[model samples]
Structures are given as C-alpha cells and as structure tokens.
Target: MKRRIAVLLAGCMVMTALAGCGSTGGEQKETETGSIENKEVTEKSQDTGESSGAEDTISGEITMWTGTWNDGLMDTLLEGFYEKYPDVKVKFEYLPWDGMEDKYLSALQAGAGPDVLDMAIAWTIPYASMGKLQKLDEYIEKNQIDVSDYYEGAVETLYKDGSYYALPYRSETMCLFYNKDLFEAAGLDPESPPATWEELREDAVKLTSEDVYGFGLCGSNAGNTTAQFYSMMFSKGVSLLNEDMTASAFNTQDGVDAFTFWSNLYLKDNVVPKSVLENDNTTNRNLFAEGKLAMFVSGSYDIDPIMEANPDMNMGFALCPGFEGKTSAAQLGGWNLGMSDTCKNPDAAFALMSYLASPEVSVDFSSTFSSCKSAVDNEKYADEKLKVFIEAINYGVPLPGSPYMNQITDILYNEAQAVLSGSKDAETALADAEASVNKALQN
Candidate 1:
C-alpha cells in the first residue's frame, strides 16, 4: 500500500517538473496564462458533440504509452476500440513511471515517439508549447465533440492560450475524510464533519490525544504541498498569480492566512503529525487508516486504498472546509490523452481517443477508475461515497497554466516548510516566495 501511494505521488509530482521541461518538433511558443477560479460551470448546459469516426473503413496502426494501468485494463478498454475499428491495430505498452520524461523526450526528439500519449494534464501546456501535441480544436469542431460534456475543470485543464491539446481521460478532486469513530470518541457528532476552518480546528483539538493526532497534513513533495496549499488559499479567495500570469499574487493577507492556518495546525496546535514535513499523500492515508490520525484532506484516489486497508473502519466525507462566507475549493487533477503532432495516423489515433472519451465509455470507466460528474450521476455506477467527490468537483479550481509551474511549486513548498518549522513567519515566508517566484516569472 505504501508502494502504491509512492507510485501515485511520483506520477503527480512530475506533473510540474515534466510540464516545465520537454522539447518538440517546433520552437516553443509563449502561452497565454489565466487565473485559477473556484466557480463551477453550469452542468449539462455545455454542448458535447458526437464521436468523429465515420462509418466507412478507416484503418491504420498506432502505438500508445501510459504509465501505470496494466495491459489487462488497456485490453478491456481497447476491446471496444478494436470492435469499433477492426482494421486498426493498437500496440500498447506500459511505460515505467521512472524516467518517463527522458524516454518520451528522447523518443520524440529522435522522431520516434508513440502516436498517442497519455500523461498528466499538467504537462499539457509545456507539451503543446513545444509543438509536440496536435491541436484538437479543429478535430473537436469537425467532430462536433462538446467539450462541456466532461467536468469543466478537467476539460479546461488541457486548454492553453486558445487551443486544447488533449482530451480528459480521468480526473480526481480533494475532499474531507474523517474517522467517524474518532468523532464519536471526541464527543462530537460522528455524523457531522467539519464544515468550516474554525470547526475543523476545534474538532482537531478535541480529537487530538497522546496517541492519535487530529490532522494529517502533507508537506513533503513540492507538487503535493503546492496543491494542498492552493486549495486552502483558494477557499479564502487567494490567487496564485494575477490575471495574465505575469507576476506572483499570493503574498497578500489571504496567502498569509492560508499558510498560517496549516503552520499553526502543526506548530501551534501539534495536532498534525510531525511526519508531515516529509509525508506524501500515501503516508497520510496510511496513518489515517492505522487510526493514528482522525481526519485529512485528499482525493477520490484514496477511497479504494482506505477501504482495502480498513474495510470495517467507519469513515465519513465532506467538502473541504472553508471560512464561513468563502467558497470551498479542491484541486482538479487527472490524466489526458493527446495526439503527437508527428503522428502518421492522426485519424486513427483520434478515433481511439474519441472512443475513450465517449459518453458510454466515460461513464463505464468511471465505475472503477475515474470521477466525472456526468458519469457519477448514474446511480447504477456510483454511490454516496463517490457522490461527495462529484459535488466537490463542482467547486474545483485548476492550477494555473504557467511555464514556471515547477518553480512556483518549489517556492511555495520551501517557504511553507520554513514557516511550519518555526524558521520564519508566514508573512516573511510568503514575501520571500513572492520575490523568488516573481524573479522566475520574469525569466
């Protein structure tokens, strides 16, 4: 289970690093940037188009590369692909997560990369900037594929400037998971979890004991820490950067408050585990399952693992708590499939991608793999546990599409760690981070 958690974190942390590096067939272009928003798109109002494949025979062989899902799952998914286009052959390979960027960039630079690539959506901007990914706007328009049919955040996560390079394959959002037994033992209502930051702090104090901490916070990985921090800041209306993405905007009062909130949880209260300094989501999940922690913030991905680890442990879920009047926010993270600009068989590649993103397949795939609101609405597939995440997705916000994404993550992680360790105050830490990040953005 620890190994699995490590693998998941490894894949995500690279989203920032991999998004910053990578070369393509053409020179890199400057991308337009936008601020992250907590607003949700009106459901079912966005037009989703039909699949683009024509009835006539369109046959060509294509290769695909994905990091973790096994061949069996791919085989099952591609069963429909093969059935739809009997003449198209797919050579699918399970690419090891380690050094995937080097392998991919090397292969792509050598003019020998897979026809279709599945990667974290965070990589979409850099990959497209390098001209390694095929633009899907024309294909989408030609196919009449309604981009709105998917979660707005998942769909918009791939868009940079005015183009989309990939289609959403899977998505996950963060939520509050509490130990019901701990709540009851603390004399709090087991059925009602924290609904605001003050409530969360109060509950944590009551839940804390010599053996069990109240919260499990993550500060180890730059990407994970940045994500967790962003959710907190967003809930208070803090923006990572100003609109147009030219400079840092998180050094304000909200930023200080957000960092202070977490730092206080660890330092002032001692309710969060000290291991948070080096803990990843997996470590936190394991601790929660072991009954060492009462509550934590995480994504839909941990559901199966927690259930597998402690099937009988009573648990509850709720939206990530925010201030009384502020909106709750969660980070939208996921994978997307994009076509290589140099692919010889783009039609075939898109045919496969289109099938994977189709309505039926999207809902079916969500049953065991991903979370999308349209799919989760089906009672036959999802239950209350999954629905909590689905509702959280409605309040989801994406990380900004900046070329210096990796630098931003590092700045936030380092400064927040400093504050949590008592080496600096939240104001000074964020001020230094703002200066460092502004310098990076200038370059």
Candidate 2:
C-alpha cells in the first residue's frame, strides 16, 4: 500500500465528521465550522431510505474470523446487520492470537477461509499484496461512506497499490502506564506522571527497588519491540525510513539515542527486570500487574487486564513522554475489517463489514480510541485515563507501508538486543541494523 505517512495531520485537529455505511440512513448535520457531520448511526437508519438497492437485495451466510477484541460485538453487530440486510447471515470464528496470522494465510491460500477477516493494519497490505484480500474501494464508494471522517492515520491503513482493501475499525496509541502507589512510595508526585523523556528516566530510577523494576521493555518479539522502541524513536522526531522509503533512516543520532536509552534501562540503569532481554509486552504487563514493574509503555488494551490482575492496585495512565521540544509519537496501531479475495458473497460481506465498521459500532468495539473521531463525545471514553489515549492519537504516526516492515522491525530489535545484552554498543548496533534493513528494503 502506498500510504501518505508521517505527520500528515498537522492542521486537522479534532475530526468533526463521522461515517456509516451499507443500508444505514443517518442524516448529516452541519457543525458551527460549516462542516457536514455524519455522526449518527442507528440500525433503523435503513428505514430512512438512504441505503443502496444492493444492501436491500443481498442474502445468505458470510463468515468472519473474529479476534479476541470482539467483546460480544458480534451479537450487537448482527442485530443491526441482520436488520438492515435481513437475508444475510454471519458466522464468526474466534481465533487464537498465537499463530493467528499464519492460520489466516493458510486458510485463504487454501481457498477455504472465512469470507471476512478482522485484520490488523500491519496485516492488511501484506495480505492484499499476496492477493488474499478483496479490494474495498468499491464498497466504500457505493455505500456513500465518508473516508475523511476517520483519523488520517487510520485511513492510511486501508490503502494499498491505489485501492482500499479494508475499513478502519479501532484506533490505538501507546501511553505510559504507571503505579500511582509506587510513585507515592518513591516520593514522586502521584498525580503527575512524566511528560518528557528526561523526567521519565529520572523518575524511573527513583521508583526502582528490590522488589520492583521502574520500567519495562518488549524484549523479544519484533512487533512488541517496535511498539515500544519505535514509538520512542518517532517521539524523538525520527522515522525508520527516509522520505522515499528507499533506505533505513533509523541510524540517525536520535534513533541511536532512543535505542541507547532503552538498553541503558536494562544494562546501564539496572532499573528494568533481570529478564529484560526476554520479556514481551504481555510478560511485562503481567509483571507490572503483579507489582514487579512500576511503569511501562502500552496501549489501552492493557487497562482492563491490569485492573483484573490486581483489583486493588492504583494504576495510572499518561501520554507517552516526548523530548523537550518534539511531538509525542505513538505507533498508530489498530485493526481493520477486511474481506477475503475468495469471498463467495461479496455484497453480503461488504454490507456486514460496513455495518460493523460504522462509526457507531466501531466506537463500542474499540478498546482504545475509536477510529471515528466523533467518539470523543461518547461517554464511554469520559474517564480521564481513557481520554489520555484519545489525545495520544493526535500525535500518532503510521507505521511504514513497506512490505519489509516485519524484517525492518526484526533487524532493528535483534541488533538492539545485542546492545542490551552488552555484546555491542548502541551506535554500532544501530549502524548494523541500518545496513541490514536497507538491504532488506532493496529486496
């Protein structure tokens, strides 16, 4: 996918519009700024007659390989989806996170996969490039869907080779998760979390103790590693690739500094876990919940889990810290609703995808920020901690659209592992990674 990445939303602040699709018939209202708003999405909108004849005509069962985040959304979605397209039925298959992507590829490659895939943004292009996903531009256009209603970063995930292959669903951004109780115990102000990289490091040092580590890292998994380190690199005002995506840009001094700082937390500062080189985000989350890790970088998905792990723990959330004079960056991350190239019921599938991805439904489905900006007004996100995540989205940056994204992550993290393990200096490790990733990109 040819994504127009980077800080593309320098001017567009809060999105005033929203969107719905398929047979829904919500009205567009005008905002004070003279912007047309398509924010409402009632299942009964079909009665308003704005729906396409195809939605009114399509029928039969369509399958969706659902993920854990479904959160009972399928029932809620079906009530509306089935109501709009009464003849269409949906079958959902919940898949395990481990090896889920490979399972998806195997099924699609074998031409026996579900009609729809609840895809991650990172998976969209890879699957589309492999001819496993169905193009979505037609469905979006035919349904009068408003693409501009979503965050620019969210919209970028759908485009590949000049066509959209999926529709944005949940939007995500990483943030700082800390223990308020630990902060207070460490003599730091519990009400205020670190807002800058310098402060984060200083406070982490103070919070470190015999039984608790101050901070954590996603040590092993490449994707998890990037979720932490790449976020820091972006906040330091850097990109993994230069403007043209032809070579690695992470060898820059800021990149090295970010990597060095992360490694030092383990090797130099000694404020991270002893197994810092092996922990993934999940491992860190468990540690943090068990009162072993005082702070860590993670997205909203962990909020509930933390509370569940220790109901009495005083956890707090903060925007990811930035440099003194740079934009905070969280890897723009989220899932998208995608269709299989081998779908037997394209119309029914599109209708189902449209209903589920509609702004109204998506907000409920998003564990983090909803891809639809209108969600800011939803009371479900009224909690100050939840709002922190919504605010982070404004600073989020899209991951590179390169097909080598996995390899790029692997090379950078593996080399950084050398630095963390005391086998190499950060600068040298970064340089080697830069060269390795550049070679991967060339292929």
Best by TM-score: 1
Clash count in backbone of candidate 1: 4
Best by lDDT: 2
RMSD of 1: 10.7
Model 2, CA-based lDDT: 0.73
TM-scores for the candidates: 0.84, 0.81
Which lDDT tens digits does candidate 2 get at residues 1-443? Answer: 23533222111111011100000012222211111111243334445756645556887777788654453455655665655665566677766454566677678768878888887676666667667789888778888888887788787778865788888877777888999999999999999999987788899899998998999876776667766777788889788887656788888888888888877878878888899778888888999999999999887767777889899989998888887787687788777889998899998888878777777888766655678887788888888778888888877777765556666776776887788778999899988888897786665
Q: 1-443 in candidate 1: lDDT tens per residue?
A: 00000111111222432111111212333322122111121111123332325633667678787654333456556655654565577776665545666566666656677888877666665566666788888888877887777777776667766777888856666889999999999999999998988789899999999999998888787766777778888898887878666788998888898888878888898899877788877788889998889999887667777889999879999998887788888766666788987899888888888888776675544323343455665655456787787777767776765556666788788998898778999889999999998897775
- Global lDDT of each candidate: 0.71, 0.73
In candidate 1, which residue pairs get closer than 3 Å at backbone N, Cα or C atoms, i.e. clash? Answer: 48-146, 49-144, 49-145, 49-146
Residue 396 in candidate 1 has what lDDT? 71
Question: Which regions in candidate 1 have their CA more than 4 angstroms from the true location?
Answer: 1-53, 363-372, 378-380
- lDDT value for model 1: 0.71
